[model samples]
Target chain A: MNTQAVKVIYKYEMLRAWNTILQSFASPVISTILYFVVFGSAIGSRIESVEGISYGAFIVPGLIMLALLTQSVSNASFGIYFPRFTGTMYETLSAPISFIEIVLGYVGAAATKSFIIGLIILVTAGFFVELKIAHPIWMLSFLILTCISFSLLGFIIGLWAESFEQLQLIPLLVITPLVFLGGSFYTIDMLPPAWQTVSLFNPVVYLVSGFRWSFYEVSDVSVELSLLMVLLFSVICLSIVWWMFKTGYRLKR
Target chain B: MSSIISVSNLSKVYDGGFRALNDISLDIKSGEILALLGPNGAGKTTLISVICGIVNASAGSVTVDGYDIVKDYRITRSMIGLVPQELTLSMFVSVWDTICFSRGLFGKKPNPLYLEQLLKDLSLWDKKDNDILTLSGGMKRRVLIAKALSHEPSILFLDEPTAGVDVELRKDMWVLVEKLRQTGVTIILTTHYIEEAEEIADRVGVINEGELIVVDDKEALKHKLGKRQMMIELEQTIESIPESLWTWSLELSGNGSRLTYTYDSYSEHTGIAELLRAVDKSGLLLKDVNTSQSSLEDIFIGLVKVNNEGSA
Candidate 1:
């Protein structure tokens, strides 16, 4: 329980976030605004309501979730990956810190950065559509949980990736498609029955559906199932990280 | 002095079945500078890595102050600081922040006064606010030293501390290392430069092909293994060795204008007087006589060559 070590690592990571203000903070905000402009104005004109909620407001939670997933993954993965790339990880590995503290520091900082971006996007969504949270506590919990879980996944990716190409491979080729197909802009109910069944298989659906439920009290899946899924994913990521540190995979050799 | 770090039967084999270390054992005394000299890929880094808890040993164990490096990692790690060979640093972080963070990572409470003095000692105080990316290679190396010392560890490992460094910085680093030695910090440094070991090390350990071939006090090793050469220049050339000097193993060179005699310096009877007397009695006109001692470099090359031949 080296709290000082954790704090030091966490603060250094956060400082790095500030140093790259444009990429860490501004990129997600601008992208979220653009989503609103394009989807709210172009798509909202034709589709007036989604499950009795205004079309513009219906996608807010999904958009925020989308930002949360990608930001958390990218931030955390790059946080760990850059250290490995620069060979500076030796410093941390040789320090008097445990693996848990190292994970806590890096994953904690990445999650915080993603959580802040999600909140900023949520506030910016207010400008385009009237927003309300039917269950604010659940919304906050889901946001925090999603940030943490995704950040852990990102940490694993950072450890597993050997090159920059591999680092971006999953986030772009896997996560972005899942987010888009998981109902970021529209509900799965609008899809054909067969496609709707397949959409349920995508893990992002559970995350977006659970997040959307907090906003409008309507979702593609039960909120309880989504919560269970997120917890399960978090546990899986934690186990892998534990095993990685124990075996010194890609870190020690 | 008691041994602060003890390694017993340590071995490391990489995933591909390449044995990087082979049953290496060593005991380092506290407050002495030990230099581990080896060629590239001689497992110098691997040995250091295992002791520092960065690389896991495949066999046996290492203990720092009697605490196991693996089971008691945190405790032992806190006692050691490593200046790695690679100049790895965060480009965006300021020098001050980097050192502070390194210290904190060791779970040490903030000691700004100590850090300030450390910066001053390394001559990095003026560039404390500047980002690491802006600093030159030499300055970055200095920062690495500052970072290693930030935790105030009793044992410090400097892995090639002066590799690729300029002559001036190398001299300054030697001075700083000596100063640190005076402060009672046990320093273990690995180097390919034999002069570095000869200049500052109290003990010298030679590792070749993943095995520690020799470890002895610097002066003792020099005296025991080093051979001296005596060169005698003659005013006139000779066609062959004089019968009077036949007992002495002397070789005529420079087209017979000079004679060289190799002898064990550590031996009580070098027989230099007898050889010179025999040469004078043989009627050889001596123009000049000089003696040269073998350096650590010569001894190292000889040892490595012999070991290679024996293994081959």
Candidate 2:
């Protein structure tokens, strides 16, 4: 399995995270604080609760999901893309490792980084609101699944991206908007019947809804569907990655 | 010295239909230093890139130590190390970390002692902890070499290893190549510098326009195509070639004071004896006589010119 090769790539990426330790852990933590102050303290006072859960507490899972999604995409994409950009990916491609090892190394490190950020944001959100957990196991499970799935997606984007601008395009124009409109800040129940039906098409609605359910047991969609969504997303991303390596697309040209 | 890497009927056609390699076939003997000499865009880099598994071959097969480059790539690639022409490196990574990381990528256990000695060999031991960005161009070049050798592969492909570095590095690199050769590492290098090949290559291959024009032992190539020249000086200036000397096909040069004869020195009858006799009989008194052999560069230019003219 070339486990040593995987370890090398994983550690190399993790070191980059450690090197930029300030930016890696601090940005999301600070962003989480601002969101709590603005949304939890300032805005939640006007709205007492969301479906029997405090308004501040309701947004906590969504906040973590938002950061997890963005962080996973950006970290994984940059990890692979920067090597390609600098033309150093030759070492990786020329190495004895298989594509699976390459993915395991790069995607695993990125997911680990995002997973840590998700935890930090969760802990930060604790000080702002009285957090409740209906299923702690499920919460951790969902967090890990989301991190892996989104990081896989980011790996695909990294291979697909040709420029730095294209690197940011998917995470910004596609991922961020989906996270926002997928019920990160609010409930789908509040929307009109037609818009609520349309929100089902957004895959992230499944992610946020299922994550929120693990916390408060109040979800717009079933938890099984959310787990299925994460699995499905990961499978699709894996297939694309497989085809990329097989065809030598963008990588071996 | 059996074949370690065998490429047969290989071809590479890019997406836009540009043929980078044209049915190129080569067999690199194990533990020998083979140098590929070619002009720009002459498929030397493309050929190395394909064998290194960085570029996909359109057709044909390459076997490394009896393993297919595609099916058994893990095994084949692990045995091969490529130092690309470009300075492909991460600016932020330390030299020590870079070499170790590259070694690990090949699934090799960490050998700090080996890496330390390697860095010392490349004169990079003192700067091992420094970031690549802070090093000079020559130092970075050394780091690239250290990284490629970190895995301790059996075969090393150095594509234009000394393109821009100073003369001192060039000399050091050749010494290193010679040392590596002694350790039984099969080295294949692509270079524009024909003299570099002539200096170090046990075998030399010339590629032009995606074709392997010629490949032979270094000395044999020079002997095969290299022309020998004889400069004959006369005691008296002559207005023209004497009628008697016309049979020798001598060229009048040095403002008619001298005659030059070009011939294949390897031939049984070089006509040197006959030409001198003709010159003596023609009363063009020879003050001095000298002979010079054409270098590998001259032979390379001659081959490429012929290939180009043939294709045109």
Candidate 3:
């Protein structure tokens, strides 16, 4: 398994996050606080509640998921893209480590980073609204799954990206919009029935719905369906990553 | 000595139909220093990259210590350390961190004692804490070497290691290579600097147009194609070659004041005496005579030229 190889890569990646303390750790904390202020105080003062949960409390899971989605993608993508861009990836490629080890190192580190950010956002959420959990285990399960799967997606994006512009393309053009329209800030039931049907197409809906259900036991979709969707998405991302390594796409020539 | 690395019928056709390596077959001995000399854009780097597992060969196979490069990659790759031609280091990572990562990357147990000494040997000990971005180009090159050696592999590939290095540092690198050779580490290097090969290589391989045209012991390669030039200084300039000396095929240079006769130095009969006699008899009074030995560069150029002409 080349565990030491994985460890060193993991530690180095973790160290990089620690080194960029403001960007890695502080950004999510500040964003969580701001999202609370703007969406919680500004908007929540009017809406009061959604689906019987306080507006401030209702958006907490969505906020964490939003940060999780973006951070996981960006962290894993940049973690890999930096090495490829700087040509340092040659060392990793030539090393005795296998593709699995490389993924474990890069993706694992990125997931860990997002996991920490998710935790930070959760803690920040605690200060603003009373936090409650119907299923802490499921909440954690959903969070961990999202981290791993999105990090895998991010790893793919990193490998697939050719330039810095390409790196930003998927996150901005694809993920951000998906997260926004995925019912992170509002319930899809509140939308026109047509828009609600359209929202089902966005994969982020399942992630947000599943995560929100874990917290408040209120979800747009069934818990089992949400879990299956997350698992299904992870499997798809996993298969893509496996194919990338096997075919030597972007990582080898 | 057993071959530490064996590449058989290796061919690489890059994505856009560029042939990087064409049927390269070679065996690197256990502890000998081999220098691959080629012009720019030649397959030297590509070949090294393939054996080191950075690039996948389109056809054929390679084995390091009897393990296939692709099938049993871990075993084969663990046996190799590659310092690529480019400055492939992280700008933000400290020198110490870089080596530590590489050491672990190759699955070597962390040995601070060994790493510390390695940094000291490369004169990078003081800069261990400094980011690679802060170091000079030469220091970065040294860091690359240190990173390659971090795992203590039996085979090391230094792809143009001394490129852009100063003369003094180049000498130091040569000394370091010799010292490494003493430790029984087999070294393969690719360089445009023929003298670097001449100075240290036990064997030299010349690659041209994605083909390994020749690989032989240093002395043997020199003995086979190493031409010697005899410059005969005439007392006065002449308008044309004397018909009597035309049979010798001497080159008239230095405004006809000198004549150059190229001959195989290793041949029992170099024909040097005959050419000189012919020159004297042709009314060219020799003021002085000087002989120059052709360097490996000349042989390399000759090989490439011949290969190019063959392709053309």
The digit string of per-residue lDDT tens for model 1 on A1-253 reads 8899999989999999998999999999999999888888687867879899988899899899889999999999999999899999988889888889999999999999999999999999999999999999999999999999999999999999999999999999998999999998888999999999999899889999999999999998999999999999899999999999999999998
lDDT of 1: 0.94
Model 2 segments beyond 4 Å from truth? none
Cα error, residue A219 of model 2, in Å, equals 0.6
Please give the range of 10 consecutive residues that has the lowest summed lDDT in model 3 chain B: B276-285
Taking the tens digit of each residue's C-alpha lDDT, what string does model 2 give over B28-47? 99999999999999999989
How well is each residue in B1-312 modelled by candidate 3, as lDDT tens digits? 899999999999999999999999999999999999999988999999999888889999999988899999999888889988989889998999999999999998899999999999999999999999999999999999999999998899999999999998899899989999999999999998999999999999999888999999999999998988898898999989988888878888898798888888887888877887777677778899999998899999989999999999
lDDT (10s digit) by residue, model 2, range A45-76: 89878898888999999999999999999999
Order of models, best lDDT first: 1, 2, 3
Scored against the true structure, residue B52 in model 2 reaches a CA lDDT of 86
Cα distance off (Å), candidate 2, residue A62: 0.5
True contacts kept of each: 0.86, 0.94, 0.88
| DockQ of model 2, rounded to 2 decimals | 0.92
Report the C-alpha lDDT of model 1 over B81-160, residue by residue, as the tens digit: 99999999998889999999999999998999999999999999999999999999999999999999999999999999
